[model samples]
Target: GAGVSQSPSNKVTEKGKDVELRCDPISGHTALYWYRQRLGQGLEFLIYFQGNSAPDKSGLPSDRFSAERTGESVSTLTIQRTQQEDSAVYLCASSFRGREQYFGPGTRLTVT
Candidate 1:
């Protein structure tokens, strides 16, 4: 019934470390999406999940990035071997068919 929510609103990790980001989409929303926004840049699509089927992960930047969503609930985005270039705001959104998505506050990641 609530809007999207993301854990660890801000994170700072050293390079090469691994980090796990979490997102909880609104209840009953069938389409969930993840995006990344670098400073002064537009949002970049990272992945999409619909229902219990395979996720559309075409937007992932590299093999070190992955995500999973169980049913229409919580989802996690894991980043392995973090690099400075990976520093950005990770955003999650969800929506039903034909409706605009509701976005989470975003996790501001800073890789040192």
Candidate 2:
């Protein structure tokens, strides 16, 4: 069984540019989540999707951030107009209901 995965593993871009990060969740998992961790900060939820439920995007920092998941599987997070403040590790996780979430290594985004 595949665990959650994310890539570029690392990203470097200039401020105001855009970046797209991808995630692949484990099979049969009905719930997916995205989080961002700034230096020395705990993981902050960015979005969550469960089955057909409406995605919870309340944690997205701004309109520049968005994500899409297809059939509880792969998901991509796009950050438009990236800013230096957006530099952080973006992590993806998946879980079955009431189970521990499995986390991806994360995409480290650096904006300069």
RMSD of each: 0.9, 0.9
Relative to the unseen true structure, what is the C-alpha lDDT of residue 104 in candidate 2, on a scale of 0 to 100?
97
lDDT tens readout by residue for model 2, 12-102? 9999999999999888889999999999999999999999889999999999999999987899999999999899999999999738999
TM-score list, all predictions: 0.96, 0.96
lDDT of 1 by residue, 1-112 (tens): 6789999999999999999999999988999999999999999999999887799999999999999898889999999999999999999999996389999999999999
Every candidate's lDDT: 0.95, 0.94
Q: Write down the worst ten-residue block by lDDT for model 2.
A: 93-102
Where does model 1 exceed 4 Å of error? none
The per-candidate count of clashes, in order, stands at 0, 0
Candidate 2 global CA lDDT score: 0.94
**What range of 10 consecutive residues in model 1 has the weakest lDDT sum?**
93-102
